[model samples]
Target: MTSDRVPVVVAARRTPIATKGARLAHVTAEHLAAPVIRACVDDARAATGARADIGDVVLGNCMGPGGNIARLAALAAGIDVAVPGMTVDRQCGSGLSAIITAGEAIRAGDDRLQLAGGVESASTAPTRTFAGIAYFRAPFAPSGFPDPEMGPAAQALALRYDIDRHQQDNYAARSHQLAYDAHRLGRFDEEIVAIGDVRVDDGPRAGIPAMLGRFAPLFAPADGELNGTVTAGNSCRISDGAAAVAMVPAGSRGTTPGLALVAAATVGCDPALPGIGPVAAITRALADAGVTLADVAAFEIVEAFAAQTLAVLHLLGLAPDGVADPRVCAQGGALALGHPWGASGAVSVVRLFSRLVRGNAPAGTLGIATAAVGGGMGVAALFKVVR
Candidate 1:
């Protein structure tokens, strides 16, 4: 493929994230994604004063019905049927993965505009069962890969890395504080689309108390010597949400293009310690982008678990200790906003668009959206302000 065109994000938006069975409980995944998809198109139209001419829509989904949720969302949003749609699954990385796919396609000289994002409606998700078995999701790991659910894996990482419960709670508290502050400042107003009565995220609670440490560890192992530091406060909650971005090639947009996709990388690591994937993935992405850590102005690292996020921070030189550095997730992260599986990573991209593209940051600023996925995968995308 020739590099005649560059991938750029023109517009982005998301529905208010709701905890499971909360305000968005009645909506299906496609139902939740439809409005945001429409809104993104509407925004692109208003910005450019012309139809977006979207050629395809790619949506990321996990635990939703097996049928193509992307096609459903597209039709529901009134997108032309001529515009085909596809769904992608990278588990937790599905959302950002979809965006990266679309961006790469755009960069490869595709003339059509693409709308890519992700959605998850845990409230409407059917309880999945193993084939002819009672277990949910799956039963066992493949031969040499040691796979554990995200919670257990985070617990193991905390034990191996010596992150304590207090430290984790402190990190959680900081996340809540930052999210609350951002909400109060209306920092998310440009990105949040209405979903029923919910106008803002429903997960953050300010003033986290000292008593958080008193709660029992949710993922502690019975045989392990360490009391697991991963807790409800320090971990993301299951939620329902959807996010979408409007993208087109360089110099071809009728709409205002914000961030140019400079470079991206998706890599895999040891399954047992999958959280470390960001370190390697981001390193390679930065190298591809031809910049160092100091060149990045902001970060949107998905906080799947406080321990895992802390580990990535340290590995990336953003933190000297296991504590969070303010530059990362300055407005909050999945810890405060909730994690809607496939939607969380897309939300990170929207966050980057918000803080760097529209915030007080200067032009040419650089930002990254990184997420550690289930199945030992990691994705990192580097974006730079072009306006």
Candidate 2:
């Protein structure tokens, strides 16, 4: 939207996503991000025909070491030491927030070649404890509201939205199938780089249809009446991965831009149902971009949980059967790829870029990346491919 300098994504790439405590357990977040960042810079140079002197790098991270992981990653990637780097945190929204910030900076003429993305090392991140009193993953609410873990919140959201266990199971099965098919077809090859021995996403198991209705209730007690639909089979598993995208002004170095960051929005909602948060953010982002949902050719809604994904789609009047909708995560999503916390949102951005620029979609197509965050928040970004 800026008249001075338009923000565009020239290239994008990501490391092979591995399940937590699996293949990536021994790799640090910085190590995982370093090579991907370097590869992305190389990709951007190829796309834009730019000199290698890229500008600042920004990365999103959560539960990593205390220092600025971005700086370390830049150094490890052998990027110019003078090119500064920083890290931002917005919990689950961290990655997309970093991308939005980079685009805004580009629009503001802050830098010519900027690298922005997110990295998470859930496998290596240290566990925290309150003096051995309790171990917690995260809280959905702050304090006053009835805060719950993500599983319970998703279950509650499903009940409120009238989505049943059967529907969630079907969605899960669909996710695995789509992911399996995409992998077999090598749809993800353009974006994925092998990290150590992991050549592809280590999540997404085949044969979901046979096990659909067999997952035990996760959030309900044995005698309880609650029919919780959120289960490990249908929810995103914690994973380790890193992803990066290069941003440059539209006219910089004659770059044939793959996507333009048209608009972005981050909104807060009732923490009681964090899964529904993306609804408001997506609406706002579309409004900001001066477009309607009908204009969007592709959609990437973070699949934190099957119930959450279904709830957001239903609330927005979009088809809850996103798997059947070619425009919505047609290549599979977080449920199958696994969620690397801070990196997942950036992964969505990367997916949009690949779908558009990898000759899989037509030019000028619009895409949206949206996510439901922990502690009652959502983030959405709009993009359009331009040759």
Candidate 3:
């Protein structure tokens, strides 16, 4: 029996990665989320030309106080108090999860209009709330579990994948080239929302290899046994940003005939190798979509680190050397465009949408966005442009 597929359409999209915003050395977390929500809501309303009431707000934020960030952001955006809001956490995949949750709600016929997205402010990373807890007093136990830090897990993946520091540096360089090319061609301008004076992703550099050479290994200690290939140069940088997307039922008014989420998959992995989670999630998403790696025209793999991306590519049989089609982030990946944790997944969605629209690729052009989470969790979503 053929199962009915519920359509979740993008009614609006917005991101705040302004050049001026990046120049600010620091900004309060609350301040960051507030303006972003307003900008996104305004854009969504304009795009749809329908001022529909938002039925729900789902936000993803990894580092925040008490997990009420979504509610706070919604309130700050002047959303009606009657609208319910909830915050979620899935490490780096939190943003994508937020979008997925909203879409699922719509698919289930639970709500008509939903606001979903993610935000991060590394400039104001909250201190660990329970540093004095008993968990910290325990002696180190070696069950092969590395520190809970995401970077260390990425380093472990580098070791497992046999990726080298030089290769990582090269990948980072390419990310810069691609990001720069996209910016020059005004590809990002579509989804980018100007806030104050900031416009476009302020952190993407032009030449990443030269920048990588200036940095040292971030996770591996100089004197310790070489643990892995992950490096600051190859991994995403700390950043502050926010992204939001408005979703409605397929037949909803003001729906854009663009990309739509085809399938979403989330998977668990050995916490020791958090970076590899994307491979499992991506595989599931591909299977559900009844497609293969060869069917995609471009990929927007979140570059949490070069090692992690390389590993996922190998698993999908689409490693850089293996596939001939150009990946959207062809210029550079997260290594060049600072990854803002919860915000990165949403950023990937925006980037993918822009590429498909500008390139005018076939409606079948598939795009995938994946992210590695703390504790070996990964999430992926497949999207296809609507003909």
Highest-scoring model, lDDT = 1
Query: Model 2: runs farther than 4 Å from truth?
Result: 1-4, 131-134, 137-141, 221-224, 253-255, 320-324
RMSD of each candidate relative to the true structure: 1.8, 2.1, 3.8
Cα lDDT for residue 293, model 1? 89
Model 1 off-target regions past 4 Å?
Answer: 1-4, 139-141, 209-211, 221-223, 254-257
Compose the digit string of candidate 1's lDDT tens values, residues 1-387. 443377888789999999999889999999899999999888877776766578789999988987899999999999999998999988888899999999977877686778999999999888766655554464225867788888888888777777778778888888888898999999999999998777988957775545567667888753466566788878888999999998887667644658888899999998888888888889999999789989998899889889888878877778677677678999998899999988988999999999987785676799999899777878999998876
Q: Rate the local accuracy (lDDT) of all candidates.
A: 0.85, 0.83, 0.70
Model 3 off-target regions past 4 Å? Answer: 1-26, 131-148, 219-228, 253-255, 320-325
Q: How should the candidates be ordered by TM-score, best one leading?
A: 1, 2, 3
- Among residues 3 or more apart in sequence or in different chains, the pairs in candidate 1 whose N, CA or C atoms overlap within 3 Å are none
**Of candidates 3 and 1, the better by lDDT:** 1
Total backbone clashes of candidate 3, pairs 3 or more residues apart or in separate chains: 7
Tens digits of per-residue lDDT, candidate 2, 232-335, equal: 88888899999989988876747476788888999999887888889999999999878998899889887889988888888787754443356778788888
When 1 and 2 are scored with TM-score, the better candidate is 1
